[model samples]
Target: MKRTLHTVWLVARRELRTRVQTRAFVLGTLFMALLVLAFPVVTLFAGASNAPEDELSASDSTTRLGITQSANGLADPLERKAGVDRPAISVRKVADTETGKNLVREGELDGVVAGTPTAPELFVERHVFPHLERALTTITYNNQLDAEMSRSGLDPEAVRDRAGRGEVAIVSMGESQGAADGPMAGISDAEKAQRLIIAMISTFLLYMFLIMTGQMISQGVVEEKSSRVVEVLLSTIRSTELMAGKIVGIGLTGLIQFAVIGVLGFTAATATAVLTLPTFTVAGLLGWAVLWFLLGFTLYATMLAAASSLVSRQEDLQSVITPVIMLLIVPFFVGVSVLPTNPDGTTGTVLSMIPGFSPMLMPMRLALGGVPLWQGALSVVLSLVASAAVLWLGGRIYSNAVLRTGARVRLKDALRAS
Candidate 1:
């Protein structure tokens, strides 16, 4: 047992050292790390820039002030006030109502506020953005309410006090309802959005990294076989040990890179409060991502390793492994795209349970804090079992085909070899 492990370690360590020293590996790893660091930062900035914008042309300065400065000048709060996303609005006073209407009709402005504060008429052909309409209604109603309050002999302070009293607090109770207890529970809308995006991005990374890394492993097989390196290594170590070592070595490199990306990206995002819910925790999701990455690599790397053994030359590599690549890539995209909206939905749940898809799907579900303990456990077990089976199969293929140097060895011939 020790000898086998030592041989595996020797092979793994050599591969790791060799790859790490390469300029391509170093540069690529650095590039991916930078991307991870940039993802959340870019996401936050993009959200700010992408907020819906509404431009309203008012009749005059007074009307524009009424629209923007109503509700005790509480129309625009730069910070998130009550967890709802607010759009950006700019109000400009025009020379006349007709001009404002023209601007609106010509698409220069979103709408025109022409009538009085009490009975303000928002003139627009179509209400494309709801935020504009809400802003108009809110300002108009506040101005009207203030007028009614003034008529009732309440001073500005008293009107403010009354309005303050009208602002009822909203309490989100999920404990009793059982709606918020899972991944989505107790998290703010911002947090939910962030989790979804993070999950999606992580899924993308997994897909990108796994497929690339698996391809590298396959290419390594072809390279070693074509160059007759495997024959030399075969004299000293068992094929199983060599195969195990290569997978482990390559997997470790990928894991380290993955860890750096996940940890740094997640930490930066959380620190920036990019999608922070009150109960937004990172450790759990981090573990989930790393675990799935390992499992995903196991399933893919082994199968790809076995597939590569079918072809001796590097050029014949693509044809042999294309199906395997597609099998993993397709599910990864689907899991990332669809799981966020319905983390606990039927499609996600089923996919997460299946072996090939589980590696990607379950992590997405985990990222959203939506996966049940049982589901996660089952996924891990299934993936591990599948990985073991594939690894065994791959070892057999590698052992059988690694010695063959001609055209691609048929699967039947490889399996029948002693």
Candidate 2:
């Protein structure tokens, strides 16, 4: 057992050194790191660009209007009708129509009102703002109605009082009743949005890492077999040892790259203020992501290595590995498409617990927050179990078929081989 472990460790060390020294690995790592760093900087700039406009809008909350003498009575009614929800209205008397138009054009006032209180002409730089327009329309209509009621010998004050009291009491049912104490409890809308972004980004990175590492393992296996490198290595080390070493080494390499990227992303996002989640929360998400990557890489790498052993050449590698690729792809698309809008939906919740799907889906749900502890625990347990089984079966197939060469070995023949 000691000798076997020593051999595996030697082979693993060799594989890791070879992979890390490659130009592709170095360049790919650097490129992905740069991209991760760039995302937060870009988001920060994008938000900063619009900051002034938003601040200006918030600071200037009052709508100033110049009203002519004929419409003087509207000053009080306009302010009153503007309502508590809308911006405050500040009305000032204007000398005449030309004067009011000049003030509006000069930007000293938001708008101008002329004619009598019942029949007002509004002037502005362009179109009237919605709140001010609504207020003017309501006040003018009420004035006309009051005049009509006076003619009919009805009390306008009583009618106005009754109408004012006829407001509809709003009852919002948009939020679930138990949301305050449920999975999403204590998270604000802004935080939820940030979490969604983080989840999406995490999902994408996991998917890419899995695809890249899976291909690397399959390609490495096929390349070694095709060049008879495995044959030479088998003379010194057992086939199972060689396969285990490759998976372990390549898995470690992938993990390093994954960690580098994750740390860069977390640092950049927090430094730029793009992510406002508690430090512990973000770190926890990163920790879970790393865990899932390890489990996912192990499960997929073993199968891919086994699948690649069925073929002797790189040309045949794609056909054998395409199914595994699809496994990764389908779960990826499903997670990204379904989780963002419905993080706690039945589909995401259930799929996140499935072995093949969990590696991709579970992390996303976790990142989005509110995932149950049992669900996460179950998914990890299932993945570990599935990976062990795949390792056993895949090791058998690889050991059986990796020794054979020439035309592609059939799956049955590989499994049935002595």
Candidate 3:
């Protein structure tokens, strides 16, 4: 037992060392870290383009405009009327209508308002600013409505009081507001983006790390067979020991890389949260991401290591391992495309319970705050059990077939090999 334990550690250590020393591993880790950091930075700048400007301006930034005396009445009396403060305009009385029109044309005035109190007209060089037009129309209506109402023998103040009192307080009911006041209605685009970013980044990295390390282990196994490295290693340790050591070694290396990227992503999420980009609580999502990454890596890496032993030549690697890669990839796209909108929907619920897929899908659902503790715990337990079964089968296939060479060895033949 002691010798076997020592051999596994030896193999794990060798694989970890060999992987870290490579230029590709070191550079790839940094590149992925930078990619994680870039997400929030891009999000920050992207929102600015859609933001409203701080200062509102119109007609060369002047708030003062001219009002002309019309055929029916002058605009002066309504200019100082009470109880109106919206769309503020400073009115200047113009003696001559044609002079006011020329002032607007000469850019000395914003525009000239000329007409009866009931029907007002604003003249600018070519066109009036839309907001200015609306404001002029509203103020004119208010001024004319009161006078018009008084002339009809109605009490204007009493009518105003009745109109203002008609406003009803709307309670947040689904049918009442057309979903405007629902529980989910308050979520901003940034919050939605953050939720998606968390879900996607977690699932995507899991897929990448699992597949990359899995292929590395497959390649390592084939290298051992082709270069007769297994014969030399076997002299000191049994085949199972060598296989155990190599998988553990490569897995530890993959875990370290995964952790680095996860930490960077978690940090970016924290910072983005300050900018109002909501994330799952740092401890909650970060912990699950790391947990799922390790579990996902273990399950896939074991199968990939076993699959590698079936093929002696590098050219045959893709044919044997493509299915395992697809298993990791399918759940990733599902989590990314479907999980955000329907975290607890039919797809997420079913996929999160599956052993292979749960590793990628559950962490996303967890961030969406849809999965309960029992469900997540159940998924983890199933994954561990699945990992154990895969490990046992992987150990057998690899131990039997790692020594064989030439054409690809079939799984059934390898399992039955004496």
lDDT, residue 329, model 3:
84
Q: Please write out the lDDT profile of model 2 over residues 318-376, one tens digit for every residue.
A: 89999989989999999889989988899989999888899999989888877656677
Cα lDDT of model 1 by residue, 1-418, tens digit? 9999999999999989998789998888889888877876776667556552212211221122222222223334211221233334556666667777777677677666666666666677665445455555666677777788788888867768766786432222211222243334445455577667767877888888898789779988999999998899999999889888999999988888788877777777766556443333455566667788889998899889888988989889999999999989789778867787678788889888899999888877766764556777888898899988988888898899888998999989998887
Local distance difference test scores for all models: 0.73, 0.85, 0.73
Candidate 3 deviant stretches above 4 angstroms: 52-192, 272-280
- Ranked candidates, highest lDDT first: 2, 3, 1
Worst 10 residues of 1 by lDDT: 54-63
TM-score of 1: 0.69
Superposed model 2: Cα runs more than 4 Å off = 51-183
Write down the worst ten-residue block by lDDT for model 3. Answer: 51-60
Candidate 2 vs. true structure, TM-score: 0.70
**lDDT, residue 202, candidate 2:** 88
Predicted model with the maximum lDDT: 2
Q: Each model's TM-score? A: 0.69, 0.70, 0.66
Q: What range of 10 consecutive residues in model 2 has the weakest lDDT sum? A: 171-180
TM-score-best of 1 and 2: 2
With candidate 2 superimposed using the best TM-score fit, by how many Å does residue 275's alpha carbon deviate from the native?
0.9
